[model samples]
Target: MHIESDQEGYRSCVNNSTSCQAYITYQALQDDTLQPVGLCFRLSVEQLAEALQIAQYLSVALDLFTSMDCELSSVTYIVGLKACRGLASEKESDKGLYLEKGITIHKGVKEHGFKTDIVVATNFLEMYSNCSSMHHAREVFESMFSQDAVAWNTLILGYVENGDYAVAMDLFSIMDCEPNCVTYLAALKACGGLASEPESEKQHHLQKGIGIHKKLQEGGFGSDIVVAITLVDMYGECGSMQNARDVFDRMIQCNAVTWTSLILGYVGNGQCSEAMDLFARMDCE
Candidate 1:
């Protein structure tokens, strides 16, 4: 919780307290009521875990849920798991505590027979991933009756985080569907984690990365500048300066990352003058 006093009349708010119950819960969570600490949490299910008023938030959610008369589905579980993320971020001890809470809620949803729902499975995978339990995430993912790109990406991300780049790449290889920008980004990051190969062997991954880039273009998913930047980094890291330059030149707009990667690539190749020039240009921009 935090507070601020400005030139205008003092105004305060709790971060995730968009609703009245949220505000009440925020106030109630802390022992001190007269002096409310201004705190803001992310306004999502994962973030809601930190609310001072868990019961209130749940009550509000339950009321609206009942009023709508919509069946509780996997979507609800996913949302709540997402809120767990916020709670996890609060502290290291809190991270495990919140994750356990999220798991319990997810288990309750499953006990009610929504276990087959993909969204719920995805959320479970996500929660487990955040909890640093890739094995649990994989278990949930494998049990999923329905899976989609997001599910794949979540698992891929978990593998990447676990430093199992080879397994991440294998997952990518076995994916029977086309990779999206997010998928490609995760794979590219995994490539960075891979063991250092000889220049010749590194060239193979470079070719594959370029192939993926072309596929992205052909699929018309060109708006992801992160993908473009990662390509430059991948090629540069692999000692392929020419390919790095090609990608750098093709970008229509250059952010700090693009400029830095290009500069670093030039520096890595002993092109000090070119790197300096690029750095100067970035400063001007």
Candidate 2:
């Protein structure tokens, strides 16, 4: 009876304070004491686990919760997947465990009927990609009923991060959705990576980088500072110092990275005098 009173009092406290509720949920999940209250409350617990950064415990809680065949929400799946991603970023030994949990949660997402939610699907794509599970990521991407620029960008960036620049470029070319700023950014990164490949691959990537630059200008991203800096870096890397200078001169505003890129471009082209002149101008500004 005393324990029951304490439980009631605690419930009352949780009811009155949002932070207290999150704390209790977090503690319950952490201790593996969370009962099958309902799907909504279980999801709240999962969210609290995410907020508390106890990703390993979150994965365990998710496994325990979903095994009971409890109803699942899109929020539950997304948060759980995010927690798995967090765990995957930890030590190598934990990757197998987290990856297994993540796969189970992926299956649960389908069984619990969230397969059609585009946002959830996109997050699944990102989670799998970050975990170095490209096969699973591609599976999620292909399973989605609808694809948006965000989804495409996620997969493209995932490929880029995995050092599969060629595959990333291939995906970009086949994307039905229009590329956004992030898409362009990832494509530029892939271009940079491609430029560093063997001699046979160098000219091809440079041309691709130039093509992407033209597309950025046409798409009205010409003035984006990051994009402009990327263009300068790309041209510099490709040994096109004149193109790099052209981009640097057209910038409405130049940051440190922009200045460094052009300076290095001149130096890389063996024009030390021009590089010094540019450095002097930068110092004056």
Highest-scoring model, lDDT: 2
For model 2, the run of ten residues with the poorest summed lDDT: 1-10
lDDT of candidate 2 at residue 231, scale 0 to 100: 84
Which residue pairs clash within candidate 1?
Answer: 2-38, 15-39, 15-40, 16-41, 45-83, 46-82, 46-83, 46-84, 47-83
lDDT of 1 by residue, 98-208 (tens): 667766776777687877877777777777777776777888888887678999999998888768788899999898666788898888777755624555667677667
Best by TM-score: 2
Tens digits of per-residue lDDT for model 2 on 126-170?
778778888889988998888999999999999998889899999
User: Which regions of candidate 1 deviate over 4 angstroms?
Assistant: 1-21, 25-76, 89-99, 195-201, 267-273
After superposing candidate 2 on the true structure, give the runs of residues whose Cα lies further than 4 Å from its correct spot: 1-25, 28-36, 53-70, 90-94, 260-285
TM-score of 2: 0.76
Give lDDT: candidate 1, residue 216. Answer: 73
Task: Quote the RMSD, in angstroms, for model 1.
Answer: 8.8
